[model samples]
Target chain A: MGTIARNGWASLEDIRDILYLTDARLDAIARDVPIRRWCECFDLRARTIFPRPKKSQAGVVGYDGVAAADVAALLIYLERLGYELEPLPLVERLMDVIRSNPYLTNAQLSVLWYERCRHKCEPLVLYLADAARPKLAETRRLRTTTGYTIEVATSADGTPIWLSASAPKYRKRRVSTPETCLQCGYVWTRGDPDSSAAHRREHKKRLSYLDPQPVVELVAAVAAGENTISVDRTSPRWKHREIYRRALAFKREFGYDFVQWQSDKGDDDPGAAGVLFCNAQNVIVGACAFRLREYQGRSWRALQWIWLAPKYRRSGILTTRWFDLRRQFGDFRVEPPVSEAMQAFLKKMGDESLMGAPLSSTLPER
Target chain B: MGDMDPAPVDVLNDEPHFLSEPEVAQALERMLNEFQRETDRGAVLIAGEMVSAQLAAEIRALAPPELRGKRINELLKYPGFLSSFSARCDVALLAGFIDASAHRSTVVLRRLRNDAAHSTDAFSLAVHRERLMQMCSLGSGVAASVSEFAAKSVLDDVVYRLKQRGMTLENEIGRNPFSSAAEIFEHLSVRPDLMAVLDERMPKMELAIGVWLLLGLIVHQGKRRRAERTTGDIDDAN
Candidate 1:
């Protein structure tokens, strides 16, 4: 096989090259784990090279048992990511990175980490908690009774830490300020811990009237002249198209469809927002696809995105940029089945229909 | 070169939306107002809106067509029993519009309101905040969204059940009242100021449904009046 290009998924040849292994050794490794599983770690599940598991009376099993070369390609991906391709559980290795890095702060960084690891980090913490072990708490991803998704990480002392998986590290933002809690019916001042505490007591016990208020001082953002464009499977720019493909693959894991892709082309609908991220130089850095659907009898825009590229990763630029899209879309909605990172961001932002943060009136020439 | 086509991406089976904390709060207010209005309907019934047989018919017209012919005179005539807010809640719940949780909260709110209404002492939401929070929290299933976490919509649940029933049932002319009701309700949710004209908070889904029902009755009544006048003219000509 030809040498793999940048942003190309691992091919069997690429895998063999990365492992520097004899074809026989690669075969043995393939027998141990399917290459598709490995590619999934890198958010490459949508690629054609990915193995499709065969149907048998033994029941539908994993991806069509992968080739040695496929496994080689996947290992190469890990090595490039600086994650050793040892036989250790992938999640453990991911956790190792997470534990050592200590800087997955804010939505962008945290999300970027997940992207770098291949959107496969969830399984690391998966099944960690079981009913029998009080200390080993399996985190439930179910929406709260009030409808928000707050994935609380607990301290050894059993206190809930409002860990921010998304943007704006909420290390201590857990006191339930009035701007944050959607499940309660009383008014509490934003950022006032005392009022928040009092509100929580009333909320947990169930007292008060529903107080609805618009968000105060939402930040304005402008990514418009930033050279954004959508990508499809046919796009020669592998990096740009790969983001949307990964999103489609992710949705499939949850058993549903997201933005339509007509073969390698995008869905016919113009409303479909697909992997749309480019810099002023028109360099691809990210992807975002959204559409307006009838929600509860009203038109609501659904947003799904991957702002995971290195260029936009560290700073809060991607999130703030994504927020800018809402200005073009007046009061677009954000909904469920969101990633842990997105959920944390939504929790902090207070789940109103996002109408892009307003652009700063102050001038800084581009 | 042509590449193999990728499968079309579509929104998944999972429902996704973008309701903020304030929107959820607004939705909750609409729901509480929904419960309160049912009680208010009973109070208004006591105020003798039922004195006009036409008004009674109009209220019933909002019901399924089969129930539209049923005389509401007896329901209207019962002053104290029908006037009780809890009784009204039971009717809405039993009508299959609200869930068990809403039924229970309505009864609880009725008692709380009664206490406030009957108390000689000055009633303050400030003093009652804790107690009110505890009571409203039961099935209200809401959390204060000042700063902790955000999710849930009191309005969604309220309207989901209502839409399920309303969409299936039609008026005398066979029009689904649910579409009109839902559109109007959605309009109201976005307009807090419009909602405040009647009350500081918007009235709930029930009131919007109520508007549709009353409009149907008025339209039907006008048609009947016009038909009668046309027949009388023919008789005069003969």
Candidate 2:
């Protein structure tokens, strides 16, 4: 508590969102690794992969099974990477593993994190840097080289090490007990460990702000059971006026979901990739669509649209599935002059610039 | 849409640049030199007494609230036994600031520096190949041997990690100011505010130094309590 004297502590929800995004790497890993059946679980072999690995037998096998601890990526990838490594989702089938499994270890979580964050680590680094920017008001004694990074206690991701700050200087002469320097002639004793009480809380509580992933996924799975999240198709339930009116009302309240996504088969670009967020029984809840579009004759990938049903906003679903979006569109640039809600989401992203140049055709009125 | 979005990603065309291995090694050397000058009296002796004492304070800060003041003074007696600059490099590695290769280099270099410091005769890289062979990074994978050039090359990249290149000393202090509290106290003693404390009491320089030491001690006592101090906490005391 003393370590954090000035700044306000983040709420559980704030921690949840951050942990969710950090764990986005895990979600990515689930999607990326190729899952050939090896008994009950999926086998991730280094040799099966193309390029350098297939030439020589350097590849080792890894598995993602139903068990909690059984969650490592291919061994070769592990050797090449560390906490900073972010590997892309090589297989789409890990989705089933993630969807079905409830428990995962810290190591497995890290591997999944790498899979989600693979190649996107630089951005993740920036994202963390944005949130845990070195404190501005922090003062240092000039000439003192003792360096310390006031750790964002809740952040799961950031620079792993900071300079160690020392305690009071003490010395012992002829006496058995050492006397500490106290200019005022005050008596002092080495206080106690930061927490004298039993450190019964697992390392996660000490190291991380909150335990992540399992519960959030459990909630999502429960919610998934109650409501459907379809890949692409939309249900006729969208035509129901009462539901439509409520959806519109939500749009009015949240400045999102102004209109239902009308799948335009005619305007389909082969480069266009999309997914739909569906409610109970396939009600079109939300859709995030991306397409490769030419701008000023320069070709660039563009986010066609990200429409979410009002209720789902801030629910962590969008962020949880954000890796899927990146996997498909390769990090789509959002059209600027976005809706207020979209802007809020971008701000959450910690890098507003990801909302790149606005779509030429879908221009918001100035 | 009349206006086209510039494509959301083009604005971020440039990625952050990282130094190559040689450059990183050079930077490590410069950083180590700077750290020595800053922490020690410009000598690279066993740094435990200088840096480790400060680091001890830090580990204490993270200690349970009760152990704040009286813990870990034994380190002062046998300072060299506590650690070397290489151990600090280990902390840097643990902190994830430096990558694996850099960390490996630190382990290797720490031994070389220790050997050179303790050597009776003039120390040379050429003579230390046997020692170099002991370094995990420099050691022969098989029952093979390494050339002096190879050991020297390892030594080059084995530069220590101090402050990151772009990060300011302020940033490092912001993270853990008390680790270098003594230096900070010395630095602050010359400040106009601290001097004003002297100016108000007595203009004599000797008494002022004594007063400053007392104040620094008092500040150290404040370290025992684990709470953020308001700006007034220190200023009003003065």
Candidate 3:
């Protein structure tokens, strides 16, 4: 076959090998995930014999049900660990190998690639340097000096209240202190007029390459088959209504089907600690806001907000972190990689499919 | 032939002084011979070295063999063994003088010899003729520097004679000397002064330069045809 044809169908064989799984144990895994065209006759091929020195009862060396089970287990494990699978297989493998053995320096991985996979050196090196490490700490610290909260008077009796301030130095201001409207009505400082007007204007500018954020945020809800992503109802600076409206507008444009509320996983609450949120490394460029809740004796986490810098697509780093986290611990209902133009983009980079089933999004038609 | 071998020779059992001329000759012979056995390309190279060494031996026939030995070594190392490349010069000259005339007809023979001396393959017959011509021209320069015998003229004379004796002049025009006076002077003289003078007076270099320009023009001219080829068939004329 020609190069393009060969490459196009290359992943199909791997997926076929994956779908080569059989037995009652993996049935839920097969059923719970979206079934593609390759799942049919998975059992028949799973049992086919090829000539080889007999090693064990398992017919093939690498394709046994145990190996498939190990893959599933790894997927579940990464979920718990809060890692994202890269859309590219080689990239995913590189990250997986690195994470599994962090002591193996990047040089050692590069040398391994040189020795075992000489032709793949460029991609391996590039992904490692550009995609993998950056994904680990893509959080960009937002310039929060301009963003402000407005406080309005809540007291029945008209009382002169400290309504406006620049960044407040420490003061013993009570929560019960008379709050008057500064800009709208919340208990935070307002920006200077010119700065506030400029900030408002900047917010109105539309940025392309910001689509990955909605997708990342909708991962959990998409898995659950839900339509709305949720952020905390009480962020003093930004209102929940605005956040939801923005997310829905993004969905309408980007075709994301679901969004769910995300609560930061705080200590002293085992249940809340399971929800996903932006980590220190993820603070600047990429952040996933998700919520974990119990449903039918199973924990379900819904991602409501995922924003990445416009520059980070195709790097495979952030996506790998997402999948790595899922495979390690979240034990999520798996999904296929993304499709349409995103698939084309990922395919150009030899990335795996990222359009996996959402942990909570609406189900595909049977 | 015995001198060409690398079998250990215990010189300690012999007189303790500088190696004799025959001894140095033997050493060079041994080095060249060993090179022959180790490489498939080596035999041709050894033959070239033998011719060069034999000619040097004849030139210094009356000198003390010891002085000749030291002189030979100096000559061998003149441009460095790798640069003034005696083995390659010998091969190209030998092929020109003794090989099939058709093989010698290729202007790239000198290049083929040089490449064979340093590398592992023979130049194929079907490369771009201009490239071969360039190689031959460059190889001639190296050969002239190494041989130091003013022998490039002799090779040119032989090529001219072949051309005069009703050999094809078309392929040789750009590459061989007889096509033009500048090339003739280049082939026949080893003097740097003479070549510098010719360079001032020559249009052949201009022609060579023009060929490069023409190549660029052809590429631009055929670009549409090439693009059509990429899309599929260029024409149904096939």
Say which candidate scores most in TM-score.
1
lDDT of 1 at B98: 41
Provide DockQ values for all models, in the order shown. Answer: 0.01, 0.00, 0.00
| lDDT per residue as tens, model 1, A229-276 | 444343333322344454544444355655334433335554565655
Report the C-alpha lDDT of model 2 over A125-172, residue by residue, as the tens digit: 111245445434333321122121122222233333222222112122
Model 1 lDDT per residue over B36-87, tens place: 4444334323222211233333335445445444345446455734344555
lDDT order of candidates, top first: 1, 2, 3
Docking class of 2: incorrect
Q: Write the per-residue lDDT of candidate 3 for residues A101-191, one digit (tens) a residue.
A: 6475433344234323322211100122222232232212221232222232222343322222112122333333333243322232244
How well does each candidate superpose onto the true structure, as a TM-score?
A: 0.20, 0.18, 0.17
Ranked candidates, highest TM-score first: 1, 2, 3
Candidate 2 regions off by >4 Å? A1-267, A279-284, A358-366, B1-238
Alpha-carbon local distance difference test for all models: 0.41, 0.36, 0.34
RMSD of each: 32.7, 41.9, 36.7
- Compared with the true structure, what per-residue lDDT tens digits does model 3 show for residues B90-207? 4333523212221232223334445656664443222333443442232235323322322343334334543442223334222322455464444336434333333322222222
Cα RMSD of predicted structure 2: 41.9
